[model samples]
Target: MDMWSYFYTCLVSVWLHRLYVYSAVAFGISLWIVIQFTTTRTKRKGKKSHRNPSSPEGTSDKVGNGCAPRQAQEVHVAGVKIFYGSQTGTAKRFAKALAEAVTSLNLPVEVINMGDYDPEDGLAEETSSRNICVFLVATYTEGQPPESAAWFCKWLEEAANDFRVGKSFLQGLRYAVFGLGNSAYVDHYNTAEELFETSSEEEAGGTDSVVDVEDLGNIMGNMKKAKREQELQEGAAGAERREMITPALREALTKQGYKLIGSHSGVKLCRWTKSMLRGRGGCYKHTFYGIESHRCMEATPSLACANKCVFCWRHHTNPVGTEWRWKMDQPELILQEALEKHQNMIRQFKGVSGVKAARLEEALAVKHCALSLVGEPIMYPHINSFVRLLHQHGISTFLVTNAQFPEEIRRLEPVTQLYVSVDASTKESLRRIDRPLFKDFWQRFLDSLKALAEKQQRTVYRLTLVKAWNVDELKAYADLISLGKPDFIEVKGVTYCGESSASSLTMANVPWHGEVVSFVRELARLLPDYGIACEHEHSNCLLLAHSKFQVDGEWRTWIDYGRFQELVREHQRSGGSRTFTAADYTARTPPWALFGARERGFDPLDVRFQRKNKARDISGC
Candidate 1:
């Protein structure tokens, strides 16, 4: 093999292992070769030593056996550094995937385990280079930092104090953190909340009782101040609000132990109201959007999920409770209210347009990117009608469903992109991971996958790879995928969180992105018909499969929005409620009658990055 191909294969192999130590070794070796081969002669100007493939000043001398060469030192500029402090492995797995997403930018990145470094010595103090720090820290028992994070916490605190006390430690330091913990944990829950709350306690105190009359006289001014105060308050409260607990829930959770951790009310997105506006809401390093543009969309309009997956990062009641059917809204009303609130949020941020003025307006206007928000949005009974309403407004919809509801999938019109989360390959593992609502959920999921294959709209089969539970089913999963024949198959690692924490699910059980990638690629190799499509190296997600849709006579894969809208509209009219049957679920959507997928002109990367432009951010109860 040629040098580049050989190096790429080696790098891919090392990354696929999912063991950080091994990956680091491979990274170091590859860096040395690249630096040796790519270095060129250079001249020094003044005192600054101009060395070919020169290291970033002090960084060159700060060496270790695992050191990367000067060219390798530039990894940070291209890729994000993901430092995960995890007890079992959830944070690490999530961090890996996040890093993959960051790498998808085509920038190289180095993913390191917090456990591998000696905090005081390992973490770089000063460097003439820019590196984005993405930390995924998970807290453990009694609301304490996880065991693996012990050194990281001590070192981080010591480093902070050292910088402040001696006045010279954090020179080039810049970072972001994602705290993985349950609100149910009484004390340290939402511990990362402090990462964003910058204002003083005094400001919070004053905002508590600002009279309504003060708001009327200076509407904009008072509202802005109030919003800022509330944002800070929410920041603090978000940091402090432990998930509400009751005796029964606690008892049930205690029995499940680690599995219970998977039961957290997934990080609820910040809600927006006229009361929470702040001057061009500055992005917080720890906020959801700051981590992934995928998280940037302003609202999760609905929160009704269908299947209660075993490893979901959602509370038990969120899936099983009987109270949900009571609170609901019409699709039209929700779109109107959500958009109006989003627009108002954008207006509030217009004050700080600053250098980002060119794209500020587009960012703030909430274009609907609705993921069946939480609960089984498809189960709404009027799901077909709802999707039609979304399409009418040119909104993009992402419907995530547990395969349990093939009946619903069949009845509804084709959505923007339909996602079927496949957690297990066989009935046994399926039951263990997804304690189904019905005894036949396994069969239903299989049936759903088969049905999804026939839908004319874009389809993506998602497999959440959990380490201990179903990692052994790689071959079986491939067989299942072959049976379904999806257009795109995405493999992602299961985060060690939510209700699963109450059971055996722990950070230790979380597999890194590379491990996931390796598994998926192997499956891809086995199923030669499928090709590796897109990959988010940092996020540890791999998209594989054949492109079935024809875009301007070119075979490709992506949602055909125009055609999707037509089908939704058609279903709304001709295929009335009475016409729906099990056969309708697999009914072929004729793409010939529908319009083609339009070339969106703009880069999706840009859209993903600049999307957070503003509006009321609401969380469905």
Candidate 2:
């Protein structure tokens, strides 16, 4: 009784205590669950006021503004039916809404995604010729159209224009286009910008002095870099426009023997935004043209870079984890492969007749080249020697750089004109805007500016203006300009669309001509040495240069073709090797232009309406 009875009693008391604790825990848990359920239900029923979650930064509604109430859906019910040439689903969403709007209007239409169709099946010219074509294309990396649209666009450009397969061909086919792109993307505005021109460099090898607008890849850059040189060359010959081309395009065009003539002839490279570049249709217009004419040349090219800038147009898909893509090719080999690819591009365009004998013969004869396409061409170890090789063939080259590597810039040969993109005014602003990968990028940029000032070759400083971001640094900009003393200064606005639309940009934020004039005018006061030489409203940019450096203090616009040719010969004689100290070069090179070209206020968006309205007449053969 003392031991066993006590042990049993103690056990019973302990069991009772345990039961009591368990009951209390269970009760508390039940109450908590009940409370949570009641609160959630109350919120769901709107017993408590609820707020819609705000969209993540850079993911706001990209359609029209909020002057009216938010519509039932994000779709624009009155827009054109979009047939997107896209690989990803983004273009699909855009096309769906576009199709819905067209459907609402009771218009019989087909809203097609290129991926859903087979590009291998040759589209009959009669089928395509009868209808108005609407191309909503998205470009892939390396300026290649999306896989879905790739073969389709290739076929369309290289073959669909032929009159034999379907008689009339694309002769009467009218079309409108809306390219979906992110300026952050590098190639073809994410591939949508490959639809404007089909045969920019179709040389018949005769005395046909037709200047092809589609052949120029650096047309935008030309307006900034080589406008004066071209103006000097043209000298009111017929009409003078700016020419631009990318380095890659330069290489390709060299392989093809097409020269960038004026501001409208070259490549327009930038991050997407709304301002002068996009408002004017030419940026993408000419780009669309280039993609059509040439198949992307480099297949297994290097994809490495030394610096990573903030305002880069490259997409997230770019290889950031790795330093290179290996399988590098010589410039001449790259040019050869590119030419072969170009033939394929033409073959795809040539319909049932296959390759026209004339076209095939023309393809055999090659001409000029450019080097500024996607990556920083200067970063290539063999850039100098490669440029020399093109020069040897009378191929004009335009080398563009971010000024990240001044040493490369110093070693660069005399091309048509060299471009250095200076994105900010001050060191701090430079860091904020360019977001350099290296610690000493700011210093490197300064050295580049000074080097550009010193170079005997034509040096241009390109300043891209992003509203609300770099609009306030007028004084700082003037200071930087003073240091560089560039022959030409091109101030352009960011293109707002695609990936950049995710950021805080508005049409209102896009500085108008008046705004740009005001800013440049202010900077002009500080930069008394540099005058506002010319203004092009269609491009949404301005040009400035040192007054003392001007040739006649008037609009000094001319390119000494003879001089350029002489320099090429000299470069070749020296094994394309020369230590180009910017200091020594600029010392003897006279200022070519007064930067006094008048301000012509024009709107490119308005021109787009005209282009779209007369699409067939403008693009058709």
Local accuracy by lDDT, each model:
0.52, 0.50
Model 1 lowest lDDT segment of ten: 282-291
lDDT of 2 by residue, 587-606 (tens): 22212212232214222222
Candidate number with greatest TM-score: 2
Question: How many clashes show up per model?
Answer: 56, 76
Candidate with maximal lDDT: 1
Stretches off by above 4 angstroms in model 2 are 1-311, 320-327, 340-370, 500-509, 574-621
- The digit string of per-residue lDDT tens for model 1 on 397-459 reads 667777877776776676656788888898888876875655456678888888887776557
Cand. 1 TM to true fold: 0.45
